[model samples]
Target: MPLLDASRDLIAAAARRVMARCDELARVSAAQSGIERVYLSPEHARVNRLAAEWMREVGMTTRQDAAGNQLGRVGDPASAALMLGSHLDTVPDAGRYDGIVGVLMALEVVRLLRDATLPFAIEVVAFSDEEGTRFGKALLGSSAVAGAWDPGWWSLTDAEGTSLREAFLEFGLDPGRIGEAARQPDELVGYLEAHIEQGPELDERGESLAVVSSIASARRFQLIVEGEARHAGGTPYDRRRDALLGASEAALAVERICRAEHHIIGTVGQLEAYPGAVNVVPGEARLSLDLRGEFDGARDSVWSAISAELDAIMGRRGLRWTAREVHSAPAVFCAPLLQDAVREGIRSTVATTEDPAVIFSRAGHDGMAIGAVTGVGMLFLRNPDGISHHPDESVSEGDVARGIQSLAETVLQLAADR
Candidate 1:
């Protein structure tokens, strides 16, 4: 019942190729040392070309969609297809395997199953953007596919003040044709994505992979606390209203409330004080609030309590406070049938009779956007340190090999039913 002893030669060979391709893709980055390929940039184009090349080698016809999503297909476009993919874009100073691994592993799955005529077509997708590095909004590529493109996104700009419409034109893509990316419900089967766990669950369980039960609903807010600024030496303790002190207490309240719950997580990831000086009492403070949970109702409930705590803190300190929501995404539960296939794949590939771990993903993904269209299923590869979105993100080759086999098996298991 050893987890890794069941590795096969064919799967290992395919995984070696997949990892080698990841190394090649990592070289196509905007950053010099670390990875930073964003949406519609030259690095993005280079990586797409590389992916198309690999797809062709596996008997897939390739093209980039209107929204710049790179795609490879094994059957006629007229036929319904099962989408398997992950984003190609990366955050600043990102690790190699966060999104790239899923795309590469999908190609390998196709390479393994190329000789067969499955019940449905298979499309390997390398989404153009997911990290939202250049554009402040995430899932630009997948959103287009899900037909969730907002007209307002065109007005969004990058750090350089270039509008999204301008960036699309610069990339030689027609923004007017973006609607061509949407896939209708009748046009395909469900989606399957193999990604790094981006957490410590699988590693902690000493397992190679796990099935995702649900993706967490998330909401973000910008909280601002305002008070009068005065000289630290001149302002009397009883007379002064320090915005920073109020913000500090609110952040602590968030942590305390979230920790008391089962799956809720609240983070004040960023904080800043105006006129940051040793002698000046802080007049204003701004903090980013990111909250997530397995259920939206529970998440919103916790947020309400946190808001009340912020209000109490502001009132006690004689400060005015305001909160504005920046983003919101509802929870998405995996289809029970797809979840079964994923579980079956894990058991067969790892040769383990032990029930595999099933966990909810607290981090958002392209699936959150894509789930608006079709059912979404995910397989999580073990990330030993539970680290992601950084240069240190990692997945062992052995685990990746297991991932390829499991993914291939998931497809085969579904095909058998079809």
Candidate 2:
């Protein structure tokens, strides 16, 4: 039977309901962190509870783990389980769709399976803290499930000095028991996630879905520039040792270098000057650099060139600087077999409609983190403006419906596989 024909109205209705709940969910997420700042706030706990309720309403069993990940399941538990889910957290002031869409889509998949009487079991998960909005550590929930959670991570704190372990405990979860969250490697038959493009690639290409091949490798660092602070009026431009100026020049140089190397992408996302005074020449500047590329070697080479440029620029300007590497993760390629399933699923959905979906994703997602442990596949709905991670990010209702149908069909195909 044709999948869309069987569940089109239900899919469309679910998307509408998901959109309707966006404001409530967003507000709740904002409230959770007590910051009212980001989408991944303490309210995410509320969102998880609501998700569990919704799963129950749809006749699925649900549970919450030590890391606060909410899991809703249907089908037989004895067989290898197919997991479909996405993170529930978001960056501060994040748009409603980023991680929410994936979670909602997973729920819709469960609803569809219940309606269709599919033979295999499906698990829907709302992973916590994928955004790292409060804790500055991304993929913590997924890492826990992958058996990669570090007990030492309990010492990690947020900007406010609240440890993640503390937060987990306060939320009625035991951090020491996080190891129990890990899934047995053989238990997972496959995994899938749906997410916003979070970039211009899909809208620019006019595609409805993207079959992600690999996630870009990423490296983040802090560049600290130090120079003597002096009176702005007393110091001549030639003689002044201005850290801010040197840092700005180095940042621009980094941008120029990355632009020159088409494969590498770099951003100086944050910059701060110490002892700010309108009349003082700034003596200390800290710049945070986020660099990414599809290839590890290419990313390393870009970093090498950027380091060289920073050294040359600082030395010529008589400034002392330190570069501290903060975070690094290698690029992740989707399993070829799972990729094929995604392509087939998308093609099945397209066969039912005149307009086919595009297939590609450039943004990092929980799928990438989970792919490290199990077979992971992803599907993306069309975003007219290709905007994400902000209030302005959006996806059309038609596109969402198509993605749901495609995902449901894909889940069934994978579930039926021997």
Per-candidate Cα lDDT values, in order, are: 0.90, 0.77
Tens digits of per-residue lDDT, candidate 2, 266-363, equal: 99989998778999999999999989888889889999998898889889888999988877778877777777777777877765443344443446
Following a full C-alpha superposition, what root-mean-square deviation does model 2 have from the true structure?
Answer: 2.6
Candidate 1 lDDT, 98-156, residue by residue in tens: 99999999999998888766889999999988888898788899999999999889998
Q: How many clashes in candidate 2?
A: 13
Q: TM-scores of the models, in the given order?
A: 0.96, 0.93
Taking the candidates one at a time, how many backbone clashes does each contain?
0, 13
Best by TM-score: 1
Model 2 accuracy (lDDT, Cα): 0.77
